[model samples]
Target: MSVTHEQIMLTSFDEASARRALALAGEALEIEADAIRKLHARLGRDDSVPRAVALMLACRGRVVVSGMGKSGHIARKIAATLASTGTPALFLHPAEAAHGDLGMVTAQDVLVAISYSGESSELAVVLPAVKRMGVPVIAMTGKPASRLAQVADVHLDVSVDKEACPLNLAPTTSTTVTLALGDALAVALLELRGFKPDDFARSHPGGALGRRLLTHVRDVMRSGAAVPQVAPDALLTDALLEISHKGMGMTAIVDADGRPVGVFTDGDLRRLIEKGQHFGQLRIRDVMHLEPRRIHPDRLAVDAVAVMEEFRINQMLVTGDDGKLVGALHIHDLTRAKVI
Candidate 1:
């Protein structure tokens, strides 16, 4: 693996090209970020945001979002964000709506039409029908005097000074502003409706927060015969065997009442060996750690994770109201359950 003269020269040229590309990327990101900031600034002074939110908040049916070209892509994303965040929303392609999908809208629904130029002919064909149905149309456009804006019930001005594109012809900054406004509308509606995390979990059951909120200790803990345990009088060898047989890497030292009094892990065995203590001279009660961390079966599994992370322990005991050991948990259990 040696570099030739041409290869070295090519590497130098590639570095310069890469630098230019990175600078361009940074500029584009900055431009998009500035557009969002401007949108945020306008939100403080503009009543359009609150008015649009009110319409959507009062809507009995889903929010029907429509756009054309690049705006259409942003509209679809906005609809997904709205739906996932408690507002019922779906994207309706303008061309498709003109063809037949306009029937999906109703008087009970709110229509959010996105067009940078506000002169999308495809959207124009469907706007009249939506207006005739008495559905409230929230127009997100760069031009306030365009046909779509004139026909809309609520006009949200999403104009940007110039696009991030070098030619200033592409829908870059304007689309970003429109999408930000869409998110602003959805967030406002959700806030006014008092939507909670549990509500969001129900909407996104497959997401990380959903798993944490919905999964319980009983659902993931090792129970019954799977829980590793030993009597206080049990021999160190016997406890070791219990831990090994259960594959929990630890065993709970229980009283005659079957309640865990202490816990002994493989770490304890290692320390005993390092101290030159013979296994024959030790009892489970003598070596085990007293009053181990424990959680209730009904508590969320995420709570268990917090306890383990705070105490820096890998295993936890699950106890019932009777103070009897019902189950055990290892960090591996959480990993396997995808709760960690």
Candidate 2:
């Protein structure tokens, strides 16, 4: 028997096996969603919003977040989210803090302690030092009246009805709820401080989000000697030479005052040539698209990418509100910048 590429590629799953996998995945999603809903329900109690917000705002030093085991993992993520969203925060391992890391905590800092049981030994060892320094502590735990919670300034109750794990041993729904609550607190602080998207971009200056928000049209646009520009009254032959010199596949047709009047592209030239029109006698104004898409230099690059996609255009003319041409950007510019 000969095995072909098609035969090798056509392997199939039995119906029962496929259904079981899909059903389990859907059940897990439902469990996680329920956990989030229940957690959100707890936000209004004890004026948690005002207290948590005040705690973060009053801290002169960085917010220190700590936890043990699985809860520790969630704590680290929460700390990262807080740091990126305008609030200064860092994660400190509870065990490490007990040994000499307590030196990192200062009178001006805020300590956020995380433990599902609220009785982690490592957390217990570090509690006295955190208090001695006059640092305020916020505890996240299943038990509000537990030792860690009783001693802390604010206690956040992350109690879940049960874990999603069938064995009831793994930290599933509880961990997710705790993480969600942390995000809620961070975002609330972001709103209170009037944190803008540009502020967020400043902290994350290396990825897609950074490129999308931090990048200005002036940064990625073809400017100076690279801009394909021609006066509106110039002959089509002159516009073609500008396009060739810039290699941007199009030339901006500007009025006598230097404001963009129209755009002439390779597409326009092909159509004109097919109509037997002579480039030598035609003016750029006669063959250019009268209303080409345009964007402002101060606007986000993501917005520029959106406009390009909506109009199916390759390039957009960057302009100032004063109607002065500033620069030009191609769809490829956005792609290379990862704004796509």
Note the Cα lDDT for every prediction shown.
Answer: 0.90, 0.87
- Residue pair clashes in candidate 2: none
Candidate 1 lDDT by residue in tens digits, 38-150: 87887768678778888888889999989989999999999999998888999999898878888888789999999988999999889888888889999999899999888
- Badly placed stretches (over 4 Å) of model 1 are 1-41, 44-46, 275-283
Judged by lDDT against the true structure, how good is candidate 1?
0.90
Clashing pairs in 1: none
Task: Please state the error at residue 75 of candidate 2 in Å.
Answer: 0.5
- Can you write out model 2's per-residue Cα lDDT over 132-244, one digit (the tens) per residue? 88889999998887899899888898988778886778999889989989998999889888999889989999966777788877778777677789998898899999998
Q: Whole-model lDDT for model 2 versus the true structure? A: 0.87
TM-score of structure candidate 2: 0.80
Worst 10 residues of 1 by lDDT: 38-47
Tell me how many residue pairs clash in candidate 1.
Answer: 0
lDDT score for residue 299 of model 1? 96
